[model samples]
Target: MTISGEFLAFISLALVAVIGGVLLLNLTKVVHMVVGLVFTFIAIAGIYILLSAEFLAVVQILIYSGAITIIMLFGIMLTRHNDEESDSKGGGWKKVLLFLGVLAFGAAFYIGIYNLDFGTEPAALHEKNTEQLGVALYSDFVIPFELMSVLLLVALVGAIVLSRNDGEKEGDKE
Candidate 1:
């Protein structure tokens, strides 16, 4: 029996997601982890496209892969002073726990996949593009959206406050 196009696409996407996740976890350096995160986001976008959510796929790539990842990279670069020695102490029981957690997650996912009977009927697609998303954001989800904006603003202010070198400069003035 031949696999359907949709099934093949889903399998490929799943493989990519798993591999990216593994790479992200195994990497010791912050930059490599960030690159793996980008790959994971791309794989998730591919999955979204396979599910016919084109707008969501585009938003995933634009917001998560582009904006969020860049912000994280900048944050890491600003915060880390000695990047070479930062990851040298990563070893011991943490690795064992991580391996166990991954094994458990894989077993659970396999069991769920084998047991579940996904209906073959196709879902009716919607045409809610960017304009519709904006309308919904300002209408139904207005409060939550505004709250998120406030949260991000607060985080930015906090980062600036924490990274200020006022005390360090005062010590040098003596």
Candidate 2:
């Protein structure tokens, strides 16, 4: 088939996202993983822009790439882990089993998706994407949104408590 600019852009963004995810999972260093995750998030934001959802693109950049990355970096700085240590304690059979399990799950998911048919009359696409999103967030999805806020608040408190414990331990040593 013929490749258009939009198709090329989409393929490039998808490759970047996939590569970034692989890097994030395989990276040993905390900072490197964060960088990989940032790459993935930025690619997702690009995809959102390509879809003509400018508001979603901005939100993805601001929330995922900006705020979430900063928060993770801060959390990394606050916590202590051995830089030179590696976690490779396992058996070969475990890896084999895990790989097989993943393959099984993928097969199941593929079969499930392949069998589905959403009847062929295409629904009208939403116009004014930002307005629709805002209305949905406030009206239908408000409870879930508020719950997410509460979860974030709890995570912040947990981080503080962890840092404080480390400080107290250091003080005892001194």
Candidate 3:
């Protein structure tokens, strides 16, 4: 089968993203995992760009690759870790339970996906997605959008507060 350029690009990006995820899961070092995460984020952004969602692609890069990754790396570095090698791959009962859980999840996912009956009708493709997105965000979804923004702001503040080195914890008697 002759694949179009767009199809080839999508496959390449998908492979890169999958590889990054696999690497992130298997890597031992925290820093190595962060690098893999960056690859995954970039690949996802590339996919968004290919789909003509330029704003989403830029937002993905800015929020995920730039901010979240940095925050995660800092969290990892600041937290203490035992340097000893662990048998992370569990033994005996743990392994069996893990296998069973994975099997159950896979079966459920397959069944859920198989049961989906999307109709054959073509969807309306909006050409001016950015304009439509702006209008919807400002009009129809304005309350939800503002609420989400406030939620995110509160979460950020909470994270900062949690990460701060408050001297009270160091001192003794209450």
Candidate 4:
């Protein structure tokens, strides 16, 4: 029944992550949603550091907080979206239904996890985790890794093409 600093850190980080997710879901503006996503990413990275996986923590910050967030911003900037608010008359019922659904889902999730037994032994995975991860990724998962890179390149090309088309259409109208 002792409270440790690690436990406090974890609780705070988890709360921040949850708040960020809620903000992301409830935000009215796209840019504000992106800010919430960044908050969630950074909080997750902090949790990773607390878990003794420094390499994973750095990767989380770099890949998610840095690269992915920047990519999202670029995507947002590339696409045009109407910012006008829509009429929401009679939306109260829909909100009530959604809230009830979420409650049911949460209850189910809690029940499922209440008596879960995942074994008692701790994994000896803290040492040289980065090196081990690199070996596994390069040797066992090389093809998938390369394929993912190719997929990303294709997405980038598609975005450029779509934006160019939009520009040409606007020019034609002028």
The TM-scores, one per candidate, come to 0.73, 0.72, 0.74, 0.80
lDDT of each: 0.85, 0.89, 0.88, 0.90
- Order the candidates by TM-score, highest first: 4, 3, 1, 2
Model 3, 38-156: lDDT tens digits are 99999999999898888889999999999999999888998898656687555587768866997899799889998798889995554887887899899999999999999999999
Q: 1-174, model 1: which lDDT tens digit per residue?
A: 789998998989888888888889777788898998899899999999987788899999999999999999998887745545455465677888888998999899899898788779895456655677788889999999989999999998997877778866555676
lDDT of 2: 0.89
Better of 2 and 3 by lDDT: 2
Ranking by lDDT: 4, 2, 3, 1
Q: What TM-score does candidate 3 get on C-alpha atoms?
A: 0.74
Q: Per-residue error at 15 for model 3, in Å? A: 0.7
Tens digit per residue, CA lDDT, model 2, 78-108: 8798778555767577778867997899799
Question: What is the clash count of model 3?
Answer: 0
TM-score of 4: 0.80
Residue pairs of candidate 2 with colliding backbone atoms: none
